[model samples]
Target: MEVHAIVDDLAEQLSKSGERWLHASAAKPKYFEFTPVELFAVTERMSLAEPTHELSADISHLVEFLHCVKNLKIRGARGYIGSSNVVWNALPFSLHLCKNILALWFTDCDVKMVSGLVNIRKTAKRIVVHYSMKNIEDLLLESSSIDDPNLLERWQRVEEVDFSFNDIDSIHPSIVLLKTMQRLNLSHNKIVNIGDQLQHLAFLTELDLSHNAIVHIDEWHTKLGNIKTLNLAGNKIANTHGLRRLFSLQTLDLSDNAISDIESASAVGKLPVLEKYDLRGNNVLNTIEYRTRVFEGFGERFTEIELDGRKADDREKDTVAVRLALQKAKKEREDLARLRKLQIDERIRFLSGEEHVARSV
Candidate 1:
């Protein structure tokens, strides 16, 4: 059942029993206040009152009510009761009451209301704070420094984090402190550089930086060596030179970028394990022999890579194969012609040796 229905039923029972605290005619408390014990007492009396339909027997409703009450957090002057937002953001309750929470999300929640998250840093595994803060540094660090003792326990065991759709321009230094982070989404932000901030996250695998302002990724080889999936689509990247050392990367998204030269983009083909890449909306796609040249760069492993959301069909692969063979044949013919010219020159020199020697003398 919905949390509001449960609260309404509980409130109705309280009002019928002459509980004037929440009654319309009786004076309401200046501030909203309720405890698990008080709720339990009311539930016990309510269950006793309904002897025909025992509240204890309806474990689902009781469990639902308890779940809602557990999230009733007090934030400055206002608080939330069940699904109703009394106003403000902060921990729904005390730290002890929130010890078991596994996932926490704060969408458009003001900065002042999120100060309470420090209390449950050790408990939450998957945390999402979207469209909330402008600078991530202010949220995770003090004076832009991650060396504080108090910030050490924050995000200790978090495996996944989504700080997308914010006004973040640069990566926060404290983000590297998430030692156990595996997947991170920083897409739809204003990030410009793939800085060394994430170099130490050895456990991170998947990273989404799509739709950002990243123009150049010059030093990514050292930093993003462990990532398997990397999304750089809809950015201003011109080439894949920075991703040459991503030996572990299997999937790469470079779509909607400014890659104009096929040779410059061929840099990603050097990656040992790169299996999929998206180069759509790039200037290189308009060049003649674009796919063939790009496939040629992969050098015998072109068939293994997926380009532009599809694998090379048999016809396209045959075309690349024929082009490669023709190029090899052309090189061999050029080498043979050069050798023949040298042989003919030697014969001519042999024939003119005496004449040439006499003229020199």
Candidate 2:
């Protein structure tokens, strides 16, 4: 079937399903369960069904009217009152309408925080905010306290979140509250640091933190070994020390960084399952034998390799293996030196009378 045709048919089905729920008894609750796409599309209509003015009387003025919405989307919204400035107080009541929300989308607006939307937290499965990047300094400016229920509520039952295209500078510690998050997008922002709180996203599989000002990274999460995709392109990154824990990553994007040499990305070779690596537009790309050395630097088998969008042949993998063997030999020397130092320390302790005795085997 054609793609648009499928979407049109799904729309018709959802319209009928929503109308049926208006008068149906509580006996049949199956109507509430909606597909991710259906829920996302249906959210635009789930608001209070009232004008923006009513929201100004009090933040909770529309609570009764909002009670019927199951998926709320308030896009391009501005306050209808004096200064017409929307604040954090304006969000909860807008989302509080439906007792059982499936998702909430606040796009192209001035929403600043996710602190007081707990009314929908119990049932909301997804929370998304993108663009409308005028005001988001609250969530990224200062880390919220761990006990704050409003901040914690936003992460409780959520599975995915996209806070992209906002000029965010830092990550709030409250991000750790997302116990069920599987995919996260913080791309196209001004972010520079991603603190230890990221380790809390233990269930994450795909992470996009591209188009930022990040210069360094440390592998902070102990449980994200299964993450399959990571996009760290378009940053000022020059170091690769913190990526060793993502052993399961299959697709990695480290293009458009400040790395001047292939050896600087030696960590990429440590990822056991890496399949796709993008390295172009960096200083090393202009060097002789740069393309061949990249395969060895990546240190893994892959179906495809794109250097400046130009594909390399399969023979490069074998060439890469030979290079990696040399790297291994260097590492073995370092390990042997450490072992010898341990032996010397033991002998010194024995001769100094700090340890007693020796047994001949």
Candidate 3:
């Protein structure tokens, strides 16, 4: 049976009993709080309350039994139990009580941030800080913004964090502290560089830093061994020097950059196992014989390559095959003609008796 169904069954049994039961919070000094592992504690966790002067008949004791709720979504609620205007950001509850909660969505609340996040450090897997002003945005994920009380402790199981379109200038170093994080989207922000701040996330696979002000190529972060799909589109990257060590990269996007020369563009060919490469909007792609030279340059190792967002179609692929075949045949024919001329010269030397003297000498 579901948890709520079990709670309903337990509540009915509590009602039939002659004994009076009160919420652990209301009883306080008179009645003792039972341990969560106890059998009676599970029944008492339900909203079944014997009549009490402190609480109404049907009031749900959040602090006493909220541990039962796995996915807790606190939406539009002004404040926590004892939250006042003076300290509106602080949620009034023992973090240990809700340690069993799996996910918490604190949305549309008065404040964007809250204190005591370190309390539920164990079971809180996903924490979404969403406050929409007609839409959601993280004004900036600066060091002071994300560095809170035991943030790394609370964000242990968090795998995805979306802090986009908030004019964030820099990636807070604490983001790299999330050892379990896999995907991070900082796109459409004001970020110019990533540096070593994001290199420590050992498990991060997909990172989107697109539409940022990453002008200089040196501003990019190296040693991201786990990143597979990187989107650095619409940046000011003029060359691909910093990307030489990203051996794990599969999909690399350098589109719309100023990488406009053959020497700068050829750096992508050294990637040991690159699959899909997007290098559109560069001057080198506009050069004459860009296709034939690039095909010879990259050596057909890249299964799919797109320059200017356009790949060679089937007919063009056939033409390239024919061109390669013809070039190979022409080279073989020249080699055979050279061998024939060498043979004829050797026969002439033998008739002139020069071959015997040369061998003896």
Candidate 4:
């Protein structure tokens, strides 16, 4: 069937519903000529009717139509909410329509209302809310109702959330409910601490707390055990003492912070699982020689380390080469030292004429 024909059929089926439902489905796929209200109702019905259910192939066709008509330009598992007025007003309905949505990207959408968005805690698997209508504080506060029976249960399914560029002071304790979250981006916020609330995120594997005001990373909480990637760039973390507890970490970005010397850099290197590290754009980068020395001291452990991207070349590759050369040179020096000691002992025997002075004597 033609796209428009399919939309028409869906709209006809949807109009049988009430006004609230119709208004919500109005933003349905363009293929259907139904009014926005009709489309909205269809989506509402879809959401409330099914759990653990897959949308029909026809629904996928409708998604495509919505993508074209709404100018969402989305495909595959991604949904784009860029510059769409529908996102701001029909927040709840839009989410209701995307019953099977796995990813949502809302860039530059005016999301002033919190109530409508709360319903989204259930369906979306991955969500990126950048340059949105509400700030982090407002969103966090809105989601703080632990007493809400459905809120916590729904949020647990979310795997990734990016709230970068939002004005947030601290992560609320209520966020612990998102136990399944794997990646969280809180960059460019006004946060100051790796607070006690963080202990709840046991499943978090990647955490981007960069560009914040955090001063320290506390190792007291063992809950960060599963974390593999952590970005503390542009923060006030001056040392690496607190990082020892994140034993499973493989990638760490600490560039552009207050780290002053090779000592702090070496401290990070001691991490057994650390494979990639970023020390670029920090005071440590000021001394080219010290940067080289620290990597050498760490031996052949790191696979890659950021060199501030300042050098007019492939600095990381160069550093790796230098580390290899340093290891070879150290081994050669050890061999030379052993030979010298043997030579010195032989000369002493000769000078004293103690060589086989007769077994008879």
**Highest TM-score, which number?**
1
Q: What lDDT score goes with residue 218 in model 3?
A: 62
Report lDDT per candidate: 0.68, 0.61, 0.56, 0.59
Cα RMSD, model 3: 12.0
Ranking by TM-score: 1, 2, 4, 3
Flag regions of model 4 displaced more than 4 Å: 1-98, 108-112, 116-119, 133-151, 220-223, 296-361
Models sorted by lDDT, best on top: 1, 2, 4, 3
Tens digits of lDDT, candidate 2, 233-273: 99998756677677778777888998787677666666677
Off by over 4 Å in 3: 1-112, 124-154, 219-223, 280-296, 304-311, 318-361
Q: Candidate 2 — which pairs collide? A: 66-97, 67-97
Clashing pairs in 3: none
Tell me how candidate 2 scores on lDDT: 0.61
Ranking 2 against 4 by TM-score, winner:
2
Candidate 4 residue-wise lDDT at 87: 33
Candidate 2 regions exceeding 4 Å error are 1-68, 77-93, 112-116, 132-154, 219-226, 298-361
Best by lDDT: 1
TM-score of every model versus the real structure: 0.66, 0.62, 0.57, 0.57
